[model samples]
Target: MTSSTPQTLYRKIWDQHVVTTRDDGTALLWVDRHYAHEGSFHAFDQLAASGRKVRRPDLTVGVADHYVPTRDRAKGSAEPEIREMIRLLDANTAGSGIRLFGLDDPDQGIVHVVGPEQGLTQPGLLIVCGDSHTSTHGAFGCLAFGIGASEVAHVLATQTLWQKPAKTLRITVDGSLGPGVTAKDLILAIIAEVGADGAAGHVIEYAGSAITELSMEARMTVCNMSIEAGGRAGMIAPDETTIGWLKGRPAVPQGQAWDAAVAQWQTLKTDAGAEFDREVRIDGASIAPTVTWGVSPEHAEPVTGTVPDPAQAGDPGRAAAWEAALDYMGLAAGQALSDIRIDRVFIGSCTNARIEDLRSAARVLDGRTTVIPTMIVPGSSAVKRQAEDEGLDRVFTASGAEWLESGCSMCAATNGDMVPPGERCASTTNRNFRGRQGPGSRTHLMSPAMAAAAAVTGHITDVRRLGDVR
Candidate 1:
C-alpha cells in the first residue's frame, strides 16, 4: 500500500511492522514490546532449553501479578507451586537483563496495567503478551494482541512474530452516554448484540463520538474486553485524550522527542473512505448499565431486564446454552436481574481497578455499608497508593469492604483470592465465564459503580436508581 491508499489504523500499524510476507499471506511482523508475568515462565523455559536469549531485552518487561498474593507480600503465595512461578519470573527477567516490577516494587501490578502506566505502550507499535487481555494496550492505537506460549517464545527470541493478518471491523458508537452508564456497560452490551464469537478473525477499531469522548482509562476498559467478543484485538485511534494522558510519563519520550512522537501518533487514524470488512454501529444513548446474567460475557442485559427464558430463544443451540447457563447459575427463568442477590462484591481487575474505577466505587460506598462481604483490590501498587492518598481506601474500608494490595487479584483466579464455591458475586472484572473466579463461583460482571450498588443492596441494582452518581 502507498501513502495515497486509504487505510485503517490497524492496517497502517500492521503495514509498518511487516518484516516480510509469505506466499500464503502470513507476515513476519516486528514486535516493539513484549510483556511477561509469572505465566510467562513456560516461554522463558523454552528459550533456555533452546539456548536462546531475548532479542530485545530493552523492549521487554516483566511484572508479577497473576500469582502474587494480595494479602501477604513478604511471604508471597501460600502454595509452593505459585511461589515458584513468581520466583522464576524474577530470575528469568534478571538473567535476560529485562526490567522487572516484582512484588516489592512500587510499580508492581498487572502486566497490562504496568505497561501503559509506565508509558511503554505507545501508538503505532506492535505489542504482545502471554495473556489474552494484552489487547488492553490497543487502546493507544497500537496493534497489540496475545500470543500462545510457543508464539511468546518466538517473539522473545526473534523480536518478530509470524501472523495471519486479521480483517478489519469498525464498531462505531454514536451519541453521548446517558448518566450513570460506563464503558464497561457499553462493551457488555456490544458483546450481547454481537454474540461471543461474532468478531472471530477480525481486529476491531472502535470509533464515533462516544468512543472518542471516553477517558483513556475508560477506553482501556472497552478494548480490554474485546477478546470476550472473539475479536483478535481492539483499537481506538489516539486523540488528544490519549496523547495528553501519555505525556510526562516516565518511559515516554521527552522534550523535542515528545513533540515528534506526538506528531507521528496524530496520524494513526483511519483515513477517509477507507473500507472495513464489516461495520457495526451502536447508539450510545440506548445502552443501559449492564451486567452478565449467565456464563458468558454475551449473556448480558440491562439490570432492568429479567432472566432470559430458554424457550424464548430463537435457535435451539442458543436455547440449550441458556438452559445450561441458568442451571449452573441456579437461576429461574423470568427472574428480574436486579432481584438476583449476590453473596459478595469484588471491585478490581486490569479492566476496572484503575484510580477512576476506585473513585467511582468509592462514590457509592462513601456513607453506605455493604450487606455482604466485599473485596477491593487495586490494579497496581501505583494505583493502590493513589487511591490511598485520595482516601478512597478509607471509603471502602468504612463501607465494610476489604481494602487489599494490588495485583490481578480475584480477576484471573490464579491467586488465593477467590469467591467461595456456589456463591454469586457482583464483580467489575471483564469475564463472567463459569469457574472463572473459582470452582462453582458464579460471577455477574458489571461496572464498578454497579458493583458498589450491589454491595450496598446485596443484589444487582441499576446505578441510575441510586440517584445521580455522576
Candidate 2:
C-alpha cells in the first residue's frame, strides 16, 4: 500500500521523478528543467569529453546572466572573454538544439528572472541551475536548487541526477507585518534568528498567515534567499495567488491544458494532517525593518538597534567576526543605525527588482531628492518597458535616482557598476559579504523601499516614517 502520510510539495515531486530507490535509501531523480548560465560552459565541456550530447535539449534553457556586463551589452562584443563565452553558449545551445534566450532577446535578462517571467517555472517540477539562486524558482512550488559544475555535466548528459531525500522544515510566520515591512525584512529576520547555517540539509516550506498574504513577487524574494540560510530548497505551496500569476504566460499551459494543470497544482499543498521533520514559528509583527551589519545575511539587526559591540557578543569567534565586519564597514560599536550614513543607494537585483518593488521605492522617493547617488535597475527589459509605460521611471528619475537598463547591475561588481572603493551603499541585492559589491565597498542590504528611504535620508532610516504603506 502507498504511504498515507501527507507529504510536502517537494516530497511529492521527488517521488514522482524517482527512477529507483537504492539499498541506502537514496533515489535517482529525473530533472524536469535544467537552467544554465554562461558559467555553465565547464559543464558542457565535461559532457563533450565524455562523448555525451545533452539528452533533453527541449527541457534545457540557457542564458547569459552572471559574468555578463549589465552596464554595456556592447561590452559583450568588445571583450574577448565575454564575447567568446556568449558565442560558446550560442554554439552549444544551437548544437544541442536547446532553447536559448540570447543577450539581444527581449525576453533575456538574469536567468532566474527570465525563467519565471517566461512562465517556464511551474509547480511540481524539478529544476536545477548552475547558480545558487536557483532557489528563486521555488516560489512557483518547484523543487529547485543549485548544483556543482560536475553535477551540471551529469544533468546535461543524462537529464537525471542522483540524490538523497532531504527532511522538511516548516517556517510559519503568523500575524500581520507592520507598515513598511517587506518579505526581504522578514527573511532577513528569519536568518538572524536561525543564523546562516540553521537550515542546513533541510528543504524548507514557508507558510502561515503573513506569507499567504504576500504577493507573488514578495514570495519570490523570500524564497530567493533560502540559500543564505543554508536550506537545500525553499517553497510555498501553489495557491490561487500563484495560479493568478500564471494565467497567460507563454510557457504556461493554455485552455483545457491550463485547467488540467491547475487541477494538478491544486493538490500541491500540505495535507491537513501533514507533519514536518522540524517546525519554526515567527511572529511577523515583532520583526522590524532589518539590515545586515556584517558580511553574512544572518548578521542583521533591527533598524532601531545600534551596531553590535564585539565585546558584548556571547561567542568569542562571533565577536571576532563582528570586529572584522565593523572594521571593514568603518562603523564603530554602539553607533546608531541612523548615524551610519550611506553614499550610494542601489535598488535592483534578482532579489528585489520586480515591478512592485519599483513601485514601493518610487512611493518612498516621490517629491524627494536623493541625498546620494541612487540607481534603479529593473529586473528585465519587460519590467523596464512596463515601468516606463506607467511613468514609474520618470518618478525615479525625477527623484534624482538614475534609471538603469535591465540586468544584474550593481548586484555584484562583475557588471562594471561597482560602488567606488570605501563607499557605503544601501543596496537591495542579496549578499553583503566582504567585497560582494566591489573591493573595499560596503553593502547594507534592505528592501527597495528601505533603500529608497535611505537614499533620501543618507542613512538607514525606518521606512515607516516616510508615509502610508498602502
Each model's lDDT comes to 0.93, 0.88
| Stretches of candidate 1 exceeding 4 Å from the true structure | none
In order of appearance, the predictions have TM-scores of 0.99, 0.97
Tens-place lDDT digits, model 2, residues 248-347: 9999999999999999999888877777899999999999989987888988999989999999989999899899989999999998887788999999
Per-residue lDDT over 322-430 for candidate 1, one digit per residue giving the tens place of the 0 to 100 score: 9999999999999999999899999999899998999999999999999999999998899999999999989999999999988888888998788889999999998
* Stretch of 10 with least lDDT, candidate 2: 70-79
Best by lDDT: 1
TM-score of 2: 0.97
The local lDDT score (0 to 100) that residue 375 gets in candidate 1 is 94
Error of 2 at 68 (Å): 3.3
